[model samples]
Target: MSRDCTDYRDIFLNDRPMMDARAPIEFAHGAFPGVVNLPLMNDREREQVGTCYKQHGQQAAIALGERLVSAEVREQRIQGWVEFARAHPDGYLYCFRGGLRSQIVQQWIKEEGGIDYPRVGGGYKAMRTFLLETIDHAVAECDMVLLGGMTGTGKTELLVQLSNGLDLEGHANHRGSSFGKRATGQPTNIDFENRLAVDVLKKRVGGIQQFVLEDESRVVGSCALPLPLYRGMQVAPMVWLEDSLEQRVERILQDYVINLHAEFVAVHGEQGFALYAERLIASLNNIQRRLGGERHQRMFLQMEEALVEQARSGSVEQFRDWISVLLREYYDPMYAFQREKKGGRIEFAGERGAVLEYLRERVNQRV
Candidate 1:
């Protein structure tokens, strides 16, 4: 008796391992979570077959593919599948669609004395459909509360501190900035979204009333937010955080020291002192422009000097003060304008810890 392909969906939702028989490039675009790539054809070979199909027709392409994959090569591929299946007996497999490639692989596995592995019903296309549908459903049902604030109000820190809520940036292993990629490298979009969906689903199952997320543009690094989620965030109630310039700057400096110290040293070398000073000045240059002309240049140079002194002395306080001053004079006013435009919907404002405690209390009261 033949096993049903539809059962693969259950396997996927359960976080069981799976394999993609499509080319690597195809898998990279999007794939189910936990799906390993064991392509029947590599990128170049896939490209050649595609070209043949377009130019010489399907028959020619099929013939060429057969010639390319000899019996011994096919056996070796089957052996690899056998090993993986032995390791994960309940594993799932997929291809571009429930097409010839997957059927061939599936038959080979069964013939090789490997346990029957379920194939995705409609293959990767079906999985993609499911993911998009799930995202849409989540967007519709949840109340999204965006955590909006100036650069260093400890928004990310507060999210981490919260026992409830999704941390999209943390899951991405990014700070959601130009300088946010991990030293290891970023995950593929499929992988990132898979992790995000799993986290969100878990929270929803645990009866989370609302998701607390940082205010981010549609795209974070290379990954794009689902359109529905982004749209919902735009209209949702926003909790803006405010802090004293002294506190905010101290927080920013501490974050850099804790998170990016090694990265800074790696990029700038042992005498990273001068390099960090320059970077700080460059960061303040944007604010300097708002300050205008000679005043901008003066503040710019002063901030640079302060940073240099701090770096030399191994004291971040002075540099933090310098940035706090810039933020007070520059970024805060912009934030004020935005807040006024947002009007009464700005539900709360205070230090991160205080705001989180207040929100948690309010939520508990409602419960």
Candidate 2:
């Protein structure tokens, strides 16, 4: 049993423990930080109960729920709550809303295990609403500097190294390219927004003078940036990282070829290399219309040649040649167009080391 009142501010500000007593399906879709799902009912049970609630009224629904969840089943759920509460004395439980579900769990834990576990103030929906609003509030208040570069200029690398960096792509779980798909799917839009909001709020609390971000188009994988943040990025000044074609090609080979291949193997094991070849071709095919017929066909052959050599020699150096061609004929032209579109917005440009050094100075001076 909880005290009379719980503050939402303390939950967000103090990094408290959270237990989500929603169904597995609900947790799988999305939930907030430190939220462990210990459902009061499983998915099918919840669905059935929900249907009963709609068809009959509250009393009828409650009667059906009691019939369905046997005493043994109820005891097991209480035991789960007891175990969790024993481990985390300060943790709170939440359901879809801060309502009957949490209260029921609270009662069960109290009677069965003699332990007290509080339910969150407003539960998932209310907490979710708070996070969603917090995003725009933080973005509006904070200053921003966007980094602009074509693929493989080490922009993502520099962003991680910098003090105030906000890696949006990392949060979204995508690389933001035609071939940028992760083996795992992107989080639901709700999850993406939650992660972004929490991160922005953290930086705001830390008193970041300028939030450093990589320039991203609206979509990363299937997750689209919220319109407000995207609009802010459009107006924000950008710093471009200038690296030589050879250097850029090397970086591409490491990321797209070597690192991607390793990740594939880690995920899929023996079948990974074959699947990697297929994905690379499919990725190139995805951009085929933009690449044009002849160029696309040529690059496809180049990729095949590179992969064959790589498999034979256990070296991905061969990917560099094809990558170099793509950089010149494909990526450079595309990036140039975007740069031209935002001509006045590019405030600084330098090679990787110089650009990083400059950013370090900027971060220090802000203090």
Candidate 3:
């Protein structure tokens, strides 16, 4: 008789470890916490099996997979399962749909290694559904505080100070701005949402009374915020961070240019540094219509000069020339106009210290 399957809920609520049996390519696109990729068939082997299924049939594909993965190769695969099972005896192993690949692995492990781990009941699809639902639940359960400010007002920094902060940008690994893409690319959309859901779960467990989120658009980098949370941010209590233009310029300089170049250069070489500079220009150009044609052209030229100066020297001091202008002519006016749309939701506005104190006091009031 077949064993009963382990479901997604069991894995999630227990925070169970999982061994993903999909190829590295599939795992790279999306994966959750408490999971590690240990493929049954690697990328090339998976491709060959896929071709077999397409040209021949399911049984032939199974035959091809078995033949290709036999001998010492088969022992190597089984050893990974044994080691993981020894580490996480309660963990479940899963593939894309709890199908043939999962079954073959399970049977192989039991026969060769004497471990009989079950697969996830509905596999990746079901677990993904659970995470999406988990996000919806978090939105409904918590009161929220949304941060607002002109660009470079240190809103994300304040999020770190708050006990209940949920930095969606941190989760997405983007700055939630045109210039925010990292040298490391953003997560796949599925993984992004999964990470967000995990963050929500963490805050919930910590007794968060009013979780804080940054002012953001419908999307961050390559991932869109889940609908319920995005909508919740729109109507939540709003607090603005107030800082002078000089401070904003300094902050943006630190973030956008001064502190950013080395990592990209180290990773992708001269080509990488050039690409990073190019992205800076592109981000400025992206707001052209709003910046107006003349101001936009001037801003582009300014950034070009700054980059050239940085290339000559070892510092990015000139980048601030463009930074100061972008803040004054572009970001501040845009934020002022946008703030009008939030209506009466603005509850407080203050400097960085005051805002942090206020958020701490609010957390105390909750207690």
Candidate 4:
């Protein structure tokens, strides 16, 4: 029987069972949800076949592959497929392009008097096409909202607390900061997009009328945000977090100090600690030497001293007040310009806890 099939769109959306016959690595990066991996060839063998194909052409590659696929090996693979098929009786199978790999497996099943194993029409490529097309359509239609703030205003924390919305940063396993690399390592761009797509699908299913996301640059580490999603975020409504410097610094230290210290040491070592201590001093020195050295240095020294005291005290209220003053004198003006440039459709400015609560209420009302 012909093994030609078209696509897995109906199967995936309708929850029809499916299995993948691609190698583990291919499936690892991205695969249709619920699709089981029943690879026809293992990693080393696949690589060897590819090398042969490149060096000696398709006929030679096929001959070498056939030699490699001993009867015993084929039986072992067929047995595994039989077990999987028995477990998922209605399951269909697919390979790279509804091609040889899938045909080999499907034919084996039929010969064994197993259940019919229809191949996905275009196989993995078709599924990928559907994912890309669906993602593009969703991006155009979805209402995206950006959650923007300075370094440590609990933007990510608040994103988690929000009852309604998607958490792109969390999905990426990143904090959306300069120091946001995951301890578990980052996902590939395709993996990241696949995760994002799954999140979007879940939100849509849950009746999410709009998405809330952080205002991020186009790239997050090695992963690039899709153009459509990025554009939606750019034009979407925004909520800027405004927190006092003392609060901001305290929050930053709390978020970063424990989780990031090892990474910082790896990157900057002992010198990093000294630099951390002297950053304000260095900035003050530069200002004093050029613009208004004396006054700037004095202010810097005071701020530096206050920071040290706050660190020593570990008092949340004290840190909050300190960050509040810093925001008024320092972070506010800088953020003002950025907000004006952003010109977001909506703006909610206040303390982190209060702002998040208000935003959550608003989102709930809308929903």
Question: What are the RMSDs of all candidates, in order?
Answer: 4.0, 1.9, 3.0, 7.1
lDDT of 4 at 2: 41
Candidate 4: tens digits of C-alpha lDDT, residues 156-215: 878877655567777677766544554446676776776677666656666776677888
Of the two candidates 2 and 4, the one with more favorable TM-score, higher being better, is 2
Where is model 3 more than 4 Å wrong at Cα? 1-16, 43-61, 68-72, 87-90, 269-272
Order of all candidates by lDDT, from best down to worst? 2, 3, 1, 4
For model 3, residues 1-367, the per-residue Cα lDDT tens digits are 1363655555666678889999999999899875899999999999999999999999999899989887898889889988887788788888888787778878877887787777787777777887898788878877888889999998999898888898888888898887887777888888899988877766676677578889899999888998898999888988888999888888888887865686678778878778778778878878888888998888889888888888878677777787888878777778999788874898888999998888778777874
Write model 1 residue lDDT over 1-367, tens digit each, in one string: 1354665435545787887899989888766656789988878888998999999998899899888888998778888887887888767777887677787778878888556766777887776666676667788976677788887787888887665667778766677753354444467777777677766666666777667888888887777777888888889888888777667777766655434555667766785555555555555564455678776776666666666666567655555555565567766787778778776677887777778887677557653
Model 4, residue 183: distance off in Å is 1.1
User: TM-scores of all models?
Assistant: 0.81, 0.94, 0.88, 0.69
TM-score of structure candidate 2? 0.94
Could you tell me the lDDT of residue 76 within candidate 4? 89
Task: Give, for candidate 4, the lowest lDDT window spanning 10 residues.
Answer: 314-323
Preferred candidate (TM-score higher): 1 or 2: 2
lDDT of each: 0.72, 0.84, 0.83, 0.69
Per TM-score, the best of the predicted structures is: 2
Candidate 2: where are CA atoms >4 Å away? 4-6, 363-367
Q: How far does residue 353 in candidate 2 sit from its true spot (Å)?
A: 2.8
What lDDT score goes with residue 42 in model 1? 78
